[model samples]
Target: MAHILLADDDKATRDLVKRALESDGHKVDLTQDGAEALDRLIAAPEGIDVLVSDVHMPGLDGIDLARRAIETSPRLKLLLMSGFAEELDRAQALKSPNLNVIIKPFTLEQIRSAVRTLIA
Candidate 1:
């Protein structure tokens, strides 16, 4: 099982995603905002293996948050999810070569598969 840091502004979405990941035996540290996520990531870089975040959010946003996290921990895997296609594309264009992405309204299997593929 992996330790994942989940950063999303929506409380309901964050809760649901956290539960889904936990059900699959992954440990999830849920954060409601990007700044807090960055702080947590910096505080425990080795404790987090993957970061699953929503692209469009208040404060730091996912792209910046992911970039900062990567700077802090180069090995951290990033998986982005967003409802906005344009924003997602823009973020992807600037993302690290190995970063992964999933669109919003995805299935549990999709999330699980993405995580597995990265970890593998």
Candidate 2:
């Protein structure tokens, strides 16, 4: 099982995602704001293997969070979800081949599949 950091502003989304991941035997840490998420990532204890985040959020956004997280942990894997996926930078979008950007309204299976792909 992998340890995941989930950052999204919507409470429902956060809860649902957390439950889904936990059901799969993964440990999930949640935060509603991007800035807080970044801080947590910076100070996170060991075993945090991946980050799943919404694109738009108060304070820092997901792209900034991903960039900073990568800086903090070069081995960290990222999955960025968004309602408006086009708003992110084109270069960054295409930069990391391992990055997964799931659009909003994704199924639990999709999230699980993405996580499994990264973990595998």
Candidate 3:
């Protein structure tokens, strides 16, 4: 199983995603914001296999966090989520090989599939 670092400002969304990923047999480290996620990634760069983050947050956003994380962990897989169309557009423009953007209101199965594809 892969180690996933999940970041989302919404508590309900974060919890739901965590449970879905965990049910798929992955170990997840949950964070409420991008700053905290970045700190965790920096603390143990090699420990995380994938980063699933929300696009919008109070501090650093998912796109910025993913960019920074890649600087430290080049191979880190990214799955960015956002309900905002503009945010999704920004994520798509990143054009990174290991990065993917998922729109919000997705089913648990969809997220599980995305995570599986990322780690595969």
Candidate 4:
């Protein structure tokens, strides 16, 4: 199983994702925002195998977080999520080979599959 760092500002969304991923046998670390996620990544660069973050977090949006995380851990796999088309477009424009975006309102299976595929 992969170790995943899951970040989202919404408590409900974050909890749902964490439970879903954990049920799928992945070890998930939950964070309320990108800033905390970044701190965790910095503190233990080798600890996480994947980052699944919401695109519009308060402190450090997912795109910026991914950029910074990649700087510290270049091989880090990213799965960014958002409901906004603009944010999704921004993620797409990043042109990161290791990055993937998931539109919100997605099912648990969809997210589980995405994480599995990204880490695979």
- Global lDDT for candidate 2? 0.83
TM-score of each: 0.94, 0.90, 0.97, 0.96
lDDT values for all models: 0.88, 0.83, 0.93, 0.92
| Best candidate (score: TM-score) | 3
Model 2, 1-98: lDDT tens digits are: 89899999999999998988898999999999888888888787356798999988878888888877777887888888887747545325547755
lDDT tens digits, residues 32-94, model 1? 889999999989999999999998899899989988888999989989889889878877885
Clashing pairs in 1: none
List where candidate 1 sits over 4 angstroms from the true fold: none
User: How many clashing pairs does model 2 include?
Assistant: 0
- CA lDDT of 78 in candidate 1? 89
By lDDT, the candidates rank as 3, 4, 1, 2
lDDT for 111 (candidate 3): 96
Candidate 2 runs further than 4 Å off = 88-94
lDDT of 1 at 74: 90
lDDT of 4 at 32: 90
Shift of residue 75 alpha carbon in model 4, Å: 0.5
Cα shift from native, residue 102, model 3 (Å):
0.6
* Residue-level error in angstroms, candidate 2, position 45: 6.2
Q: Between the candidate structures 1 and 2, which one is better when assessed by TM-score?
A: 1
The superposed Cα distance between candidate 3 and the true structure at residue 95, in angstroms, equals 1.7
